[model samples]
Target: MSESPSTRHPRELATAADPAWVDAFVVELRLLGVPGDEIGEHLVVLDTHLRESGEAVDEAFGDPREYARSLAPGGGPAAAVDRSTVAMAVLALVGVVLVPAALGAVLDGTRVTVTLGGVLAAVLLGGALAGLVLPGAPLLALLVRRRWVSFLLAPALVALGAGLVLLLPQVLVRVPAPLVLGAGAAAVLAGSVLLARAPADLVTAPGERASGGGGRLLGLLVLPVFALVACVPVLLVRLLG
Candidate 1:
């Protein structure tokens, strides 16, 4: 006699316990342009089925993205982009780029010297390059489980920004404070604008979400905390030297 369907898929018993998989499924469905109410209904049904049957997601309905696509035909790779995703990306990028710059400026004050100006230019260039290469480094880092990369990115931005602030006083003739601050703010704003206009598909992935609340809070705090710790050494050097 053939084994029963549920008995045949004993491995699927674990599916009901894993909420991440369901979250990912809902995300993909949202990306495919499924209405919010419809998505919620689908999730409720799936959750009910999983609870009752104790089947692995793949065993019951196949891969989440594929399953969603099957249900919503034509909601494939070419689906219309969600504006909220783009807006979130823009806000995140702006925050990552501008926050550190603003902090650094506050620390450095208005005194500008030639050496400081040169350092500022180099740091700005480096930031520009990072923006070009990483584009949405902070947000991307948050989505994926690349802990080391994520940890490093925000600190690096802060360090560069702080370094620029430290150097700002060395120049004999300082650029106006307003210009420096304005430029940093404007650059980040422009970056946000560009990101907002990028193809939706490129900006957000199906099933992509920010990490948990604790992780996000930590991600935001890391830069400032690092900046504070880093300043200790700089302060000591200034005092001792």
Candidate 2:
């Protein structure tokens, strides 16, 4: 982010003398994966310094982004984000790949068909989506951050592989349909529970959650959405069969 001079606020802003600098600093820290609470404490320190020194923020702090980096270079207490991202990836994998196989079995009176290419496609697509949600992963994250074509192209490539899995004769193993369905449903339920305990859901009070209402709404819909995904294949199978 570019550095710019900003006027100092007098006492009312509560965090820092320069609102612009303070905003940039907070944003940079969040992008670095610093936890929300820790960022608040850091702001208090900056405000205290500014009050004592009576100096222009730009003169004293140099640049907000640089200062934030110096304070939180490795990022503070974001294991939650990383863990949530992994849970999301697992949910994606089981929900997409296993459900379709189970559907194939129940609808066609066959065991759940599996292929090497299908598994790889599921993993890559799942990982890529997870990496987009939380940065710092290799390849996918870099591609997204840089606006590289991988962000646009990865899903298309995975789709191509999925189409080939249906067309080509490459059976890896056939899992019992009922067993696959049971296991996939259980895993998805477990992952949803973990997601419910994620940092976003840990926000204190109904009012605070309302502040991020869209995210909170999505969190509320998780169970129903998961149920819908599980039921979709069954509906498709019945309709098409």
Candidate 3:
């Protein structure tokens, strides 16, 4: 008699699970903001079904990404970023802006001040960066569509951005070093607090994560980590120079 999926050794069940398909499904679910633990459970259940019926993933689920959209809490990924998370994102955005401002302040030998043009440049660039997000969706879609294209897409985008930076000149502005750093530190701290208070979006199981859901500490660490990354080089420059 064929063993039921539940009674089968876990190793057998795991072997039956299609890791590639599972990864694609998980990515779609994550983009839809499905909880981590719930995603893990769904993976297990899908694996069980696959074992029991001996069906292909494509046959069992028309498209994993579409299935994820259906599973979204409010029936879509549209409003997945709750208001509080958006607030956290804003603060994080501020942190991103300050990095370039601070770096421009240091590089131009205007450690105490930068021009208004610099700050304005950050703001304008932020909006442009937002536009690039649409391209990211296509990149994610390529996960299932054409994976090799994805492999090339990532580094190409990075290279393009780097090349653009070299072509553009830094705009100087009043880069009040202490004030900028202080506000940056404040923004990072505030963002961290918001992230902590932000609902635990990723309902990960004991040892499972839903895509990029790195849980609370990881969320909290993000701002400060980036802040340090921004500030450390300036500190190094000051110390040696």
Q: What's the TM-score of every candidate structure?
A: 0.41, 0.60, 0.63
State candidate 1's TM-score.
0.41
lDDT for each residue of candidate 2 in 90-124, tens digit (9 for 90 to 100): 77567655665676687778898778767766666
lDDT of 3 by residue, 1-241 (tens): 2221122222232355566666667777766656656775676677778889998877887677777677777676443345665566667878766765566565666664543443444555555444323423433455545768757866765565555555554645444666776777678888998876565444343354334345568767878888777777677776688
lDDT of 1 by residue, 1-241 (tens): 2222111121232236356666556656655566544554466567679789888767888777688777674655434434544444444444444444444544657432336655675556455444433423433424343447757876776687667667565645555545554554554454444543443221112233212324344444444444345346545654576
Predicted structure 3: clash tally: 9
Output candidate 2 Cα RMSD. Answer: 8.1
Off by over 4 Å in 1: 1-20, 30-35, 48-56, 78-92, 111-175, 179-241
**Candidate 2 colliding pairs:** none
| Steric collisions counted per model | 7, 0, 9
lDDT of 2 at 130: 66
* Shift of residue 89 alpha carbon in model 2, Å: 3.5
**lDDT accuracy of residue 124 in candidate 3:** 55
Error of 1 at 147 (Å): 7.9
